[model samples]
Target: MRAIQITEFGGPEVLRVVDLPEPVAQPGQLLVDVAAAGVNYADTHAVEDSYLSKSTLPMVPGGEVVGRTAEGRRVVALTDGGGYAQRALAWEAMAHEVPEEITDGQALALVVQGLTAWHLLRTCARIAPGESVVVHAAAGGTGSLAVQLAKQFGVGRVIATASTKEKRELALELGADVAIEAAPDGAGLKEQLIEANDGNKVDAVLEMTGGPVFDASLAALAPFGRLVTYGMASREEPTAVTAAGLMGRSRAVVGFWLMHCVTRPGMYREPMAELFAMTADGRLKPQVGGVYPLTEAARAHTDLRARRTFGKLLLDPSR
Candidate 1:
């Protein structure tokens, strides 16, 4: 099997394609023939050795994948790592049947991205009907799904922040009530979010961009609202916040890490199944931004990290 191997902790060129032995499954695990592998910011973190619990160098670096088991059942799998390849291993518990309604790429898209979106909205934030939400990176993989889920939650208004006009438009099409270019100060964007909700503070915010934007996201929350921060795509430098931000309005701020949620399926099973049901029912349609051959895994990562693609990027090993 050919896989993308990170021999060094550096640039995209460090991700070299080479023939490696195919992975074999252990008891209670299944091997999937890689059909599609999900590219994520997590991959970037791992390659740079910035992620928590960094791996030894030269390991294949992918955190989530969609493929079949050794028996050839059509299924999806989650991995601790090693998905940028022709074959990978997954715990049986992490495996889920891909609904016929979902394309292979869409299935790949939704599993990690979709599952993260599901856990974030339904569990971490517990979005309420009629409340408003501000979704940061609203055009990316997780944000796109968050917008759709906020609609499903019956949020009366949704404020989306995107990196580009084209991506912002995609957020609107995904169901955000209003979409705007994210502001540099993050203050102007707060005002826009308030006005969009009829001068009401946001009921909840799904934020991934870290830094001053995080401070604004918390400040934008409505009295008694919730703010969930999951990623730091924006802030390379840390930003500080005061507890006063939470005290006055009874506003609650929390952090969400989907990896932590996924590791504890006992916490996520019922809802994940429900998300799959939503996919079957056509209430949730995850976008697969681009599909690249597995051999082009480096290009996929480059495209994703550069923010040139929308929705989920998938690698097709079989292709």
Candidate 2:
């Protein structure tokens, strides 16, 4: 089997293509012939050893894949690891049969970014109809889905922020009520968000980037607003929230990690099923920003880290 391995923690160049013996399915696991694999910021973090969990040496970096099982079932799965290979293993419990209407790349996109977007809006933020919401990185994988889902959930206004003009345009195409440029250091972000929302503070905010962006988002929250922090894509040091700052506004800051939900069977399974159904019916569309051959894993990481790509980046192992 051909796999992309990270023998050391560093940059994209560390992702080396190597030949490894095929892995067999363990009890309760399925050995999948991988078709497409989802590339996420987490994978990049794992390669650089900055992820939430430490990765061992010579580790396969992908966390999600859309593939076929030995029995020929087309499925999208959340792999324990090793998704960036011709063959991978998935726990049967975590695998969902892909609907015929969904493409392999789309199915793979839903595994991580889809679930994260769903939980961020429906569960973590608990957004209600007619409320105003703000989504950062609105043209990226999770952001693209979040923008569309917010509108579907009946949000009165969806404000999105992206680093570039093209990304902002894509966010609008995806259903954001307003799209604005994201400042490099989040300067004036609060005022820009309020201006975009008709001078009103947002009811809910999806904040993944830490540093100045988090600071601005936290300040932009309306009274009783909620902000869900999922990741620190900025790679900046953690921001400290003052209890006093949140007291007067009755605002709340919550943190979310998909790994926690994965441990509880129903938590992951239910929303995933809903997302799949929505995708099948054409309600939810997972954008494929770029697809790279397995050997070009390094280039994928480079594009992702540079924030030069929008939507989900996928790797075709068969290539």
- Among all candidates shown, the one with the greatest TM-score: 2
1-319: candidate 1 lDDT, tens digit per residue: 8888988897576888889987877898888887888888878778878765667867898877776666768887778789888888888888788766767877777777777887778787888788788888888888899899889988888888887999999999989989988775576777777887788888888877778888777777778888787877753543555577468778887777766766574655666677788877889888888888877887887888778988888887776
Q: Residue 136's C-alpha lDDT in candidate 2?
A: 96
Please give the RMSD of candidate 1 to the true structure: 1.8
**What lDDT tens digits, residue by residue, belong to model 2 across residues 81-115?**
89999999999988998888889878877889999
| Clashing pairs in model 2, backbone N/Cα/C closer than 3 A | none
Cand. 1 TM to true fold: 0.94
- Candidate number achieving the greatest lDDT relative to the actual structure: 2
* Residue-level error in angstroms, candidate 2, position 266: 2.9
Superposed by TM-score, candidate 1 places the C-alpha of residue 39 at a distance from the truth, in angstroms, of: 0.7
Instruction: Report residue 281 deviation for candidate 2 (angstroms).
Output: 1.5
